[model samples]
Target: MTEGTIPAALDRAAEHFAGREALVDGEVRLSYAELARRVRQAARFFEGHERVAICSPNTWHWVVAGLGALYAGATLVPVNTRFTARETIDILERARVSALVITGTFLGTDRLADLGSARPGTVLRIPVEGVEEPISGVTEWDALTGLDSDFVSPAEPDGVSDILFTSGTTGRGKGAMSSHRQALSVAGAWADCGGLTEQDRYLVINPFFHSFGYKAGIVAAVLRGATMLPQRTFDVRETLRLIETEHVTVLPGAPTIHQVLLDAPERANHDLSSLRLAVTGAATVPVALVERMQTELSFDTVLTAYGLTEAVVATMSRPGDDAKLVANYTGRATAGFEVKLGEHDEVLLRGPNVMLGYLDDPDATAKAVDTDGWLHTGDVGVLNERGYLKIVDRIKDMYVCGGFNVYPAEIEQVLSRLDGVAESAVVGVPDQRLGEVGKVFVIPRTGSALSTEDVIAHCEGELANYKIPRFVDFVAELPRNLSGKVLKRVLRKENG
Candidate 1:
């Protein structure tokens, strides 16, 4: 009944399952007690460190490092492991994070050693057996693994817990100042909505650096006493076997993962009946994909959630949501919040879950969170008379042709429904006379002989004259970020 803060909840978990496997990485499983002990040891090292930047995959070690920061009362800055050296430097400088914890040989660079020499804080390097050359000033992880595990969880509650950087969708990345309470609030909401239980086992495929996985995937599982099955990187076959062997019951990932799993050959042969629920979100998903999951995978309990890194999950669909309802929109934008359509149908939300402000940029923070606390989501949506929300498109991504507003999602949805098309991306391209026009990027289904003309012709019938794409670009696959959302900005730059 410790209902106050995240640190308290974590302590409750440590007591609840002292010997139960709480985190798994390959063949290695750390019991809740062992995980807690390691975190306490690391916490002792980070007692007064300015900030601890952890760069690791979704493994038991990563969780221990995060909890250590919490207990040490130091701000936790989790850098994306996929980030290049340049990107890492930007985040490190912006957050003023001096100390760093990184895995061995990330992107051909020793991140821990690099940061230790370049920055002004302690650097701890985690070595994978048989891989890396030991560096001076880099504390070996094994040294701390055997340290006394009886350190105290700090009671200081005013310190910032995490400074999570946004993915820079609009412009440059900005760190969102998150307190322990803010992060836990998001985890609590997910637990309430998802019906998380100790009996459930989670497959953590989403990157732990992102708020979606950190808050919804990792913290939610921990709060509910569920075991977290970690994977260093996603492999189709590996994921199937893990589920079959580990009996993982819960999976939270982007729509692309669900699509990939449904298409994988092992899915039919694997015993995935233990998968009681699956959650998909992070980007706009086609209704067809959701339908395919239900029919093909027999996942009766499926949910499509909506959230931003600024405040993890805002809204989600529950079990009783009409099957047709979950098929359409990304759930009713959050119960503890209110959403309104702004100019050009932009979906604006005001709620307690919205962050206080961005780390150092007050102006940008002002623009994102208004005076009344409504966070401008920049997404276009429409609420039907029945109060069901349907996303139309992103406001910035919307195009105009001679004063006619065009939502690319409408065109893309139509494009995806076409036969022989596998994946599609629609973006606005510059047009001399029209100001802006729609362009479609098509990825034909494997072994399909679909032509650009066939796709355009199909869209012509289903879409309005202006909404029809003026040009079609065929790519083998769409360029996507780590979260699996198509990087249309990249496509726009390429075409431009």
Candidate 2:
């Protein structure tokens, strides 16, 4: 089994699986030895930087740049590609990023121009879809690759490796810091559970910016020497083509991704017999969907898991589990984690893989992890006698929409700034397509006229598309408790 820092893991993979294919992104294919060489070259560009941020879709460039930063002993901070310029700038400033690796013109948006003056001191622009208008002062991806240096920073096991930002109930984003040991431990646990091997061709559909893709997808593949086929964006046709051509054996994503593939009209025309494993979670997994994946999609093993940014891959179903069990419950705890129910049936986790703490927030850290070292996951769940975990509700008033965590407080804070919006409350309502969609109840200020379009338009400028409310309702007043706290339960109940 591979152990120690991420950089060490990469070197081990290069030595053990030197001739094996490592990454296949579009036309770029690299062996383990070649990937190590490129990572070392890229590391020299980020040698002096302390924090490096990557804001791009999943591709070969993202993997190289991210691993390079880690090789240089720089903390990696991945920014969401869907975030607006303002939102991205906020994270960059908070993390004190000194270097940035951004996509050059993707989907008609020039990310370099969007960042403007807020960009870090050192910027490496990846020509993902070819740079439309070359911006001066920004180093192109090719330029960085050409640089030569033998600088390799020694990474400590306990040193912080990455800071992944997740929204808090306070309407602020909290950076969850994890050490090299913690990150690898969880990745190894996940890889072991999934039976990842060198012969496996894993198709990573999850965005690299998210924990699922970065740690579980990238790090796990490196640990097991699995070949990675990264998809820049999720397209049904492209996914089918990759499975047939690349002989993809492992596919893990949200239930929605599988549902789309199964429901696609042209699904039968493609060859999908190569698929062997499917791991899904982040939202409700229907029993029918899991059964169909086995029967219709020919997936040998289908599993479901429950985790948060703080403790990724805490609990996961095993391979032999039935479809009904896999769909109904996120499997028993793995990765040396102890799971138990606390007050109100809240799921409490204590493990080595839990995050060290929220970045620079001691107060919040103390609130999350008690002195007993048990991290109080605000999610309410049930633990069966057999040690399975079934998530029931979220105490944090958060929801999962299309596999993305959406905090109502974050949206309410953005709406509070909008003109003619005196007060607002947001809740997650059931949806047929997406597991849940945001529905905001707004109380307009006296003598102010506000339409649903106006409220949505205001949010579009300030928030990510997933964070914005899909449905808006204008109300005269909000329901509250005696202490004047907004009764969100009442709102959710009424909406449901």
lDDT of 2 at 1: 22
Estimate, for each residue in 119-171, the C-alpha lDDT of model 1 and write its tens digit.
54577766643357667676778778666767666644444778888644342
Task: Choose the strongest candidate by lDDT.
Answer: 2
- The TM-score, computed over Cα atoms with residue i paired to residue i, of candidate 1 is 0.78
User: How much lDDT does each candidate structure score?
Assistant: 0.75, 0.92
Assess the local accuracy of residue 314 in candidate 1 as a C-alpha lDDT between 0 and 100.
Answer: 75
Among residues 3 or more apart in sequence or in different chains, the pairs in candidate 2 whose N, CA or C atoms overlap within 3 Å are: none
Alpha-carbon shift of residue 310 in model 2 (angstroms) = 0.8
Kindly list the per-residue Cα lDDT of model 2 for residues 1-496, writing each as its tens digit.
Answer: 2248999999999999999999999789999999988998889998988899999999999999999999888899999999999989999999999999999778888877888898988899888886456677888888866778465666778889999999999878999999999989999999999999999999999999999999999999999999999999999999999999999999999999999999999899999999999999999999999999999999999999888899988999999999999999999999999999999999999989889999889999999999999999999999888999999889899998989999998899899999999999999998877899999999999999899999999999988888989999999889999999899999999888
As for candidate 1, its clashing pairs are none
For model 2, the run of ten residues with the poorest summed lDDT: 145-154
